[model samples]
Each structure stands twice: as C-alpha cells, then as structure tokens.
Target: MTQPSPLSDRRVVLAVAVLCCFLWGSAVPALKIGYGVFGIVPSDTATLLLFAGVRFSLAGALLLGYALATGKPVGLDRRTLGRVSLLGLVSTAGQYLFYYVGLAHSTGVKTSITTSSSTFFSAILAHWLYTNDKLTGRRLVGCLLGFAGVVAVNLSGAGLDLAFSVLGEGFILIAALLFSLGGIYGKRVSGQLDVMVMTGWQLGLGGLMLAVAGLATGGHLGGFGWEGVLLLAYLAALSSAAFALWALLLKHNPVGSVAIFNCLIPVFGVSLSGLVLGESFLEWKNLVALALVSVGIWLATARKDSVVGRPSP
Candidate 1:
C-alpha cells in the first residue's frame, strides 16, 4: 500500500489531538467509576488516593518501559533532569493529586470545566515566564472567555451533584496553576530530552512520589478488582499516550496553539458525561458559553497582526 501524503499525516495529527481531548475528557468519569467499583469516592479517602496513586504508578512505569525499550531512559542532562523533576512534582503530583481528589468531590462536567482553565492559566504563565511567549489583546480576551465558560458551566450545574462550590473550584484552580507551571517547565526542557524520555521520567518519578505520599496519608491500596484493572488501564494507556503526544506537540509546535485546544477539554468532558452518565445534552447556555470559549481560545492563542495560524488542526 502507498504511504499517505503529508496532508494526510497532518490530518492524522488533528485526529490524534481530538482523540487525546476525548480521552483526557473522559478521565473524570473514569475516576467516578473507580469510586463505584472500588468504593473510593468522597467517603473513601484511602481508596481514592490509592486509585490515583496506583494508576499513575502503573502509567509511569509503562512510559519508563517504553523509554527502556527504545534504549534511552536517562536522556536528560542534570540540569534538565532537575527541571523535569520540578515539573513532575508541580504538574504531575501537585496538579493530578488535587485534580483526582477534586474529581472525587465534583462531577465529570465540573471537573472538565475547572481543569479546562489550565489553558488560560498556561497562557498567562507562558507569557510571564517565557519572554517569547508574550500575550496579545486576543490572548487576554481568550483567557477571559475561557474563564467565563467555567462560570457558565458552574451555573449550569447549580442543582446537580457536579455543582461547583468555592472549595471545588479552588481545587480545580490549584490544579490549573500546577499544570501551567509544569507546562512552562516542559517548554524549557522540550529541547533537551526526547519527549518520550521526559514523559517517562516525569510520570514514573512523579507517580512514585505520589505513591509514597498516598501511603503516608493512609491512602488505601486494597479493593483490587476488574474495575481497578480497567481504571488503571485507562489511566495508563489513554492518559499517557495523550500526554506524550502533547509533549511532542509542545516540543515541536507553539505553546499558544496547544494551549488553545485546552478548551476542547470541557467539550469532551460534557460530551462524555452525557453519553456515559445520562446527563442532559447541550443547552443554549452551554452553546453560548462554548462560543465565548472558542473566541477566547482563538484570541489567546493566535498571532496578533500576522494572520498566519498555527499549523491547521
């Protein structure tokens, strides 16, 4: 069979991004399911941490395995390794710990909405940290729009179990902060190590750290079942693969473009929630909010005077 053209490969990349969005979007629901099967919901602290810890641990190990199989597990210089470690601590540990725990407190939709703000936070953080990543009026507007989208989502969830209280929103917001720091660190190290190697180290080492923290915090490790395996599998494969792709994109592409796609998190989150949880489908408010988010993402990520877009998709 003939190889596909470059255009086709580009299409493939967009397709992969969409898939990554979907999988990442579905992560909260998977956490919910973990609560059900393993009894690890809000009431079960030990199990909840275990749920996050074990899945992350396995995911990290798997990525490391890939690194080893590819023959370069230790590819970073000491300085780069230090950066990766710091990023892993902040992004993977600080971010995901709160995120998963927040998932325990909120619904799939709420989690998505809050986590979706990572893009907005990342935009600001990138501009602050990276001199080349200065933001324009569009970017600022986009960040505001995305924030408005979160407000819209919370308003929509007023009566639902997924409703966002200040506490829940706070958790998600903290997660976003950690993610932004991690993303910035990733940007710095993107040139140093292979994406796969960096991911493996980050995930593997970070996961190990979380496991130790989980154990110390009395996070249970029991309740192994099919659900545990499935949750672990989903977290390991889908999440890791998307992140690796993201790291690759961040390595080779612009931060703004990748950041713009952060809006897709809520879209996929709401979509998966409806399909998987029987939540009501889209409402007019959601549509309006989505439009705002779209405009915001465009402004935040796109160039100001130069109409040249990031590579299509």
Candidate 2:
C-alpha cells in the first residue's frame, strides 16, 4: 500500500476536513427530516435507538463492502478486534445514545452549542496524550473563536433558559467528552489497523449492540415507508464516509488540528436547517459566525512558519 501524504499538507487536510464536517453538518437537518418521516417523536427513545442502530449497522456494512471492493484488507487480529469494538462502543453507540436522548430533552440550538464543546475536550485531551500536539496560545484562541461562532449562530433560536436538566444538557456534554476520547483512541488504533477496516468493525459491533438494546426494549419504527428507508440509507452513507475519512485524518494529524474542524459541524447544521426547514437564512449573525469560524480554522491549522506563506524558520 502506498503511504499517504502527511496531514501537514494544508490543502489536502483542509479539503478532506471540510468535506467531513459538511457531511456531518448535513446530518442535523437530515435527522430531523428522518424523525418525521419515520414517525419518531421526541419521546420515542426506543424507536430513536432502533433508528440509529439501523443507520450505523448499515453504514458499517457499506464501509466493509467498500473496503473489500477496493482490495483493502478486511481481516483484524483478535486484539485489534477487541480494541476496535471498544472504540465503536464509546465513539458511536455510547456517544449517540446520550446525544439522541439529550437532543430529545433539549432544543436543537442548545444541542449544537453543547456538542461543539467536543473540540475543547479534544484539544485538552491531546495536550495530555500527545506531546507534539501541545496546547498553544494560537490553538486556544482559535477554539474560543470557533466556540463563539457556534454561540453566535444559535443565539437567535436559543432563547434564554435558566432551567437545566441532567438528562438534557448533561448528557450532551457527556457525549462530547466521549467523542473526544474516542477520537484519541481511534488515532491510537489506526496506527496498527487499516482505517476503513477499523471503522467498519467498530461501527458494526457497536451498532449491533444498539440494535439489540433497542429491540429488547420494544423499539419499532411506526409507519415505515420508502422515504424513510431512503433517508436511512443516506444517513448510513454519510456516516461511513465521514467516519472513515475522520479516522484517516486523525491517524495522520495532530488531534487538536483535526479536532478543530468539529466546530464547523454546527455552522453547517445551522445553515442547512435554515434552508431545509424554511428558517430565515439572512441573519447577520450567521455571516459573522462563519467569518469567525473561518478565522478559527486558519489559526488552528496554519503552521507557524506558513502563516504568511513563508518557508519554515
């Protein structure tokens, strides 16, 4: 197999990272539409799990199929299997379990803002886990700017709420933390395993667990239709592509560098929600938020010597 270029190649990293974040951003609206098509109300915990289980399981299958077709090795050693399964559990099943329930209890705006905290978690974790990815002033400023953009974009819809719930905001934070940990762990695993293969197995194993739990709890989609199936398929494809690419990126880049892109997810989510759900798209804050996010990405990812297109010192 040909060795891929280092993620320090700014152009390739930016393109792939943007694509991954855009796919994830689209999921926000896609999932909202999916819930309606599948007749899953906010209170439908079991059905939500069932829906997510199906989506992820299918995504795993698609990734594995792609790997086989592309002649990538699909076999994993027993130890690798165990590690990948653990990664899947924390990253996919556990993260989404909390996320779905939390989103159900909280508003979409709040969910987006809270989940954006994962970048902070990842940056902090990387400082401890990776010597090369130490926390720096530039990275901190970038993360804060991106976080502010997230807050700015959601400000219109997120009316002040003094009340907070453990199940609502708390779970979202937990999911964010778990997601950060999962990214770090995934980087470790990808060093030894093929990125696609690792992603496929973990998603399959974790998704199977979710399916079993949902089924055991009497989860079933009501009024299943062709539209619902198609949407589910779309979601699965997004997961397979985004996660595999993400794993690959994390394997080659500093965790903080790649993790900073997570801030883009909510930006894409808000913009898409406006277009798809007929919300106002002309808000001034939206533009400001995007500008801030752009600056944030630049600051976080740009090499010190390359800041002004200068060669390394």
* Superposed model 2: Cα runs more than 4 Å off: 1-6, 157-159, 304-313
Query: How would you encode candidate 2's per-residue C-alpha lDDT over 1-313 as one tens digit per residue?
Result: 5554565567888999999999999998898899888878878887888888989999999999999999998988788888998998999899989988898899877888899999999989888777678679999999999998888888865465646788999999999999999989988888788889889987887788788778888899765688888898999999999999998888777888888899889888888988999978678888988999889989988863211111112
Q: Can you write out model 1's per-residue Cα lDDT over 197-271, one digit (the tens) per residue?
A: 777778766777777777887877556777677777887887678778777666544465567667767766765
Q: After superposition, how far is residue 265 of candidate 2 from its true place, in Å?
A: 0.9
Q: Using TM-score as the measure, which candidate wins?
A: 2
Clashing pairs in 1: 46-220, 138-299, 139-300, 142-296
Clashing pairs in 2: none
List the candidates' TM-scores in order: 0.80, 0.93
**Relative to the true structure, how large is the alpha-carbon lDDT of every model?**
0.68, 0.85
TM-score of 1: 0.80
